[model samples]
Target: MSAIASSTSPQPSSSPGTTRNTNVTILLACLGVFASYLPVVGVAVALPVIQQALDASTAGLQWVTDAFILPTAALLLTCGMLGELYGRKKVYLAGLTLFCAGSLVCLTAPGIVLVCVGQALAGVGAAALLPSTLALISHVCPDRRKRARAIALWTASLGLGLTLGPVVNGVIVEHLSWRWIFLPSLVIGVMIVVVGMAFLKESRASRDPHLDVPGQLLAIVAITGLVYGVIEGGSAGWASPAVIAAFLVAGAAFVAFVVVELRSPCPMLDMRLFGSRAFSGAAFVMTVTLFAQVGLVFALSEYFGLVHHASTLDIGIRLLALNGFTVLLGPLVGRLMNRTGPGLLLVTGLVISGIGALCVCFFHASTDTGTAALVIAVLGVGIALAMAPITTIAMNSLPRRLAGTAGAANSALRQIGSALGPAVFGAVLTDRTLATLPAHLAESGLNPADQGQVGGVVAHVGIQAGAFLRLDTPTATERALSAYGASFTDALHMCALVSGIGMLVAAAVALVLIGVRNRSPHDATPEPATA
Candidate 1:
């Protein structure tokens, strides 16, 4: 084992030329994060249009987002080490290059499969970009206060990308093809690559970085298997052989991962970090909170496009209520963080988020725009409140020596939750809606043959089949529409119950495990960050 990197201040002489270089590096680093997060929510917002255009299934739609997130999550820990061994600037630009390539692929894709492939490529790029950007900032601004400020701006840029995803894609898809969603990302990515290559200085650590290849592969399999099982189970059947196999593989791989980490001399994640109650509690809170936030974004997008038949731009505007508060409440959230305990803030936020999700249970097909926005705003507020405290809880609970791996693991878990959010929520929505759709159709006063015909169309077209439910005689479109809406609303209720109750349960767990006290030992100093 080697001594860590951040022992002393590495701030360069405060000259005008050096200052200019540092500012430019920070700008590029911020842009890298912005680009990484841009498509995360954007792709989810575009799910409805992609489904309709490609005639995709529920599982296929889940993959469209998960493919990007899965690789990003699985490879995150490894990528940082790679950058440390090689060079941060090179890895940073490599990440943008791949992201641009993914965007190009998406721009030209003719099928859902191709789109997923493109997203997977972008996911790999994101994995590389996130950590290298942080390393660049750490390298350029070595003074603790300045680095902190740079990281804050970097964090804000990430939130901006997430917040704006819906609006950007909404505007683009409304005017052109859904594929145009990638055009802006593509152009920015290419520009960054070109500029960064010219001006971005290279930096690397002094040692050959440790590689945990086996643990990395196992972690990937575990997450991919779990998500695939959930998504495919709904589309196929719960008892299907493939689903059974995926679950079994995931379970086995997870166990193997724990064992490998415990025994490895140079583990990717320090398993002992979870021994702290605060660390465990904070990790759980982040995972569950993000699960609700990202999952709800997906559900609402589908609701607006399929249930209410809203335009792309309108759907984006309505969804804005969900994330707009995060940006608006930024200063407030920061002030509250200083005045309150992370555990307490997390608990309060979860309770408020639970109430917000519970409110979503009341929404129906005819629910007006204003009412829906109000409920989403409450949920968004809770998310914003709960989000930042997670970092405090996790980082403070462990020794400074564990900072890099601890941060990496905490971040990886959050991404895992993100990947699963759409997979699990979309699956639940599809399962309940399809299972009870027949009963609603039967109650529509339509005869058996006509009922079966409409059912077939629903099967072929999936949730957005409301537009194709016309009948020749004796059957009215209103009856079919009523049946479909009722079924979908019932399904949405199940998702709401899960999200609402899940948050409350997570709050209880946090209360049991976390404390308000300062938990870190003062004996060890923080090692220098070695991206």
Candidate 2:
């Protein structure tokens, strides 16, 4: 490993001037994260509405979300490197500009294609923002304890964006068009850019090296191919030639990436970083916990809309229980992390969420708001506990100059996990629902003809057959609804089990390798005149 990678990150002196700059930088960084995340759950909740308005196919609808994820995942490392090479503030500003433009495109979009184009633009911007924001925090905060507190706030901001995305969009769609969902993200992004340009400090790697072209290309290919396979496997048959080809491409690209990184003089992502047990453990835990949380949110959102037939606003309100706790408990979690270490908290968070996931199996089509809120609250609190610690763990594992790369690697992995969440859970939902369809339909007392009708549509669109389920055939329709609801709940349980198992695995990883203390030394005098 390069000596720079082993050195502690720059520790800004604790003078009044630098302290003021750090606070502003942290606030701006949090806003940047918040802006990037607004479209995530916000757009998700609006999918059905988009479908109705745009008359989109299932594949097109999937692309609406996937378009945003692909560039964010594919370009994170490159963007991180760019921030490391150039100035982080410059890249961050550029990201905000792109995001603003993308938001504008989506806001005024005339059709589904334009919406996708807009989302892709925003994804690229997010690619720039995610790592730069982290790098900024890692570079600016002089004190480790303060860094922990700042990170806690940063994580809370992320959760707040996610928590409010649905509610904001829901309220928008209640009176306005679905297009208005893009507005909040746009407004916030632009405001951040304007303010940040004046106040945010600049930082970069102390050393410069040639870009690892081969490694970067392979990483893009691997991530894109893997996401494509999982996404297609759910929509297309898993054994289909395209899906299989995508997996093969992803696997091959990943192998090539490993080989290239090992041999490269200046690898885009350092191969040696993974040699540390702490780094590896934190990375793994980050992926699985994200997979569980994002997957749970995706599954439960479907449950509220498809099975419970809740309105968009109603569903968003109910989901507050799932993400709001992160905001409520984030600072406290940070303080606890300082006192108790990240290891105990990370494991406890995972276990609590895991148990809550199991509790999801108890939910049914007839579950009331109160009952659903309680169960979701438990999962939210658990995930909130686990979220901040891993980021700190990953940061502490790496030394100063590699802060941007570490942030990139961490963000990339988490984004990959988030992208996988819906695709994997949706696949499980569709497969399980179809596999158990016959039994439910038979019990519904529907005739052979009606069974074939409901089964065919569900086979084609899975649980998204909300409109088809609303067909008015009196007793037959009612029976079909009941059968579909039962099948959806069964699928929900399967999804919950998958996520719960993932959480347990993460908890185990946390206990073994990721310790509770900061590994990076912070003894150096910090840079002067940051702003």
Candidate 3:
């Protein structure tokens, strides 16, 4: 971390009149935020319906999800700086309006292309809401415990949104149309904007610098290019010319982004934060943990829908095992943080998530529903344990004034992990499916064309179907099942290895960098400062 990268002074205290204003402002802020984030998880349940409705190709299916995340990843730092410069309240309100506008786009989109554009717009809204919400929270809840609780509540909203998104989408898509997903948010957004107009006070940042225009542009281009390349790489072979070109451009852009940030007078993101042992360590762990969680979600969605032939509603109910645990455990873990701090919770959470990954790895093609549910539930527990602690560590490490930017950056990191995890893991699974299929085809005595078809089927169905296959097979059906069983197990093994490696890396960093609790807000007296 650059030495100069240390936190600026804390914001001034709220006067009596300001206190009441802050509370109402925060309430509106929270509601707007919740409405925005609600879409993140909500779309998962609608994936199948959208796939069918749009006649989406296999590769196109991945893009549907990636489109929403890529823009959010690309523009996070830029939007944060916007809030820090103009005022968080203004930035936040603009984000809400954009989100609702994006929702409108999604609601009326006639094709996947338009829908994707809408998702990208929502990503912009995310970039805006994510950071500004944390900033406002810091301003509103000054007490450490109160702030921590509020942070926990805010974080929980993310998990809650993900969990409920599916349930709501499932019911809506099942009964009506997919457009309803975006429609509800528009209504809620209108209310938030109305309430916000009356109560929210504009908060100018306590410190500001000349906006680093060149650096901001480079960072956005680099991240956007990188994510686009990765997602495109997954669908197109990584070696494809277009994919390779994206990677090259992304690499060059990233290099430029780094150079610009290092020299910029007013860098959007403090590049020095990466040098801090604590920040870097926490950020890495948080990123990797999110990768596993989201990757698992992508994997399971395929497993349930394609293999188990589960309905969206059923998938929602089934995934409740995972999301349910997350919803239940988040608050309890937050309360625990008050006494134990976050390090232990992080380690424990990762361990559980690792274990959960293991459970998923061992799943048999014929694994009972009860058993599958248990495995998913365990993974959820791990996520619940890990998410809050990592967030708290990241937030508390910073000066209170930068809390919003830190929160937004943290949120962005998690999404980056979410984006990369599924892409990489999906690649691994795809490669393994291709590699293992030739042998399975030969073993089953199928000719080349039949073999290719089998490989394609296995890619989609093996995760669920292979789990139940018996190894000793005399019949043709038995033989095919055995092959699938082996392939699925191999894929699961790969997922386990990835999860284990990520967890071990996180655990090592946390053990070394995280020390005894040292800093507290009470350490200094409040003072008014200028932006």
CA lDDT, candidate 2, residue 325: 92
Best by TM-score: 2
TM-score of each: 0.84, 0.94, 0.87
Q: How good is model 2 by TM-score? A: 0.94
lDDT of 3 by residue, 1-531 (tens): 122233433434333136567567556756766787678877867866887888876566666667789888887877777776677788888988888888889899888888888888888887887778877777676566666666666667677767777888889998998889787788888788777766786764555455778877887877777787778777676898988888888899888888776766556666666656667777888888888777777676656664466788888788876666666776787687776767777777788877887777777556678999888877788778777778777776556666666767787787788788778777877677557756865877645555565565556654334434333334644556556655655665677678766776776677677643533422322222222
Return whichever of 1 and 2 wins on lDDT: 2
Order candidates by TM-score, high to low.
2, 3, 1
**Model 3 scores what on Cα lDDT?**
0.71
* lDDT per residue as tens, model 2, 16-84: 246778889889999999999988888988888999999998778888999999999999999998888
Sort by lDDT, top down from the best? 2, 1, 3
Using lDDT, give the best candidate's number: 2
Among all windows of 10 consecutive residues in model 1, the one with the lowest summed lDDT is: 8-17
**Cα deviation in Å at residue 7, candidate 2?**
6.3
Query: Where is model 1 more than 4 Å wrong at Cα?
Result: 1-29, 44-62, 84-90, 109-114, 133-155, 194-208, 396-404, 438-461, 473-475, 516-531
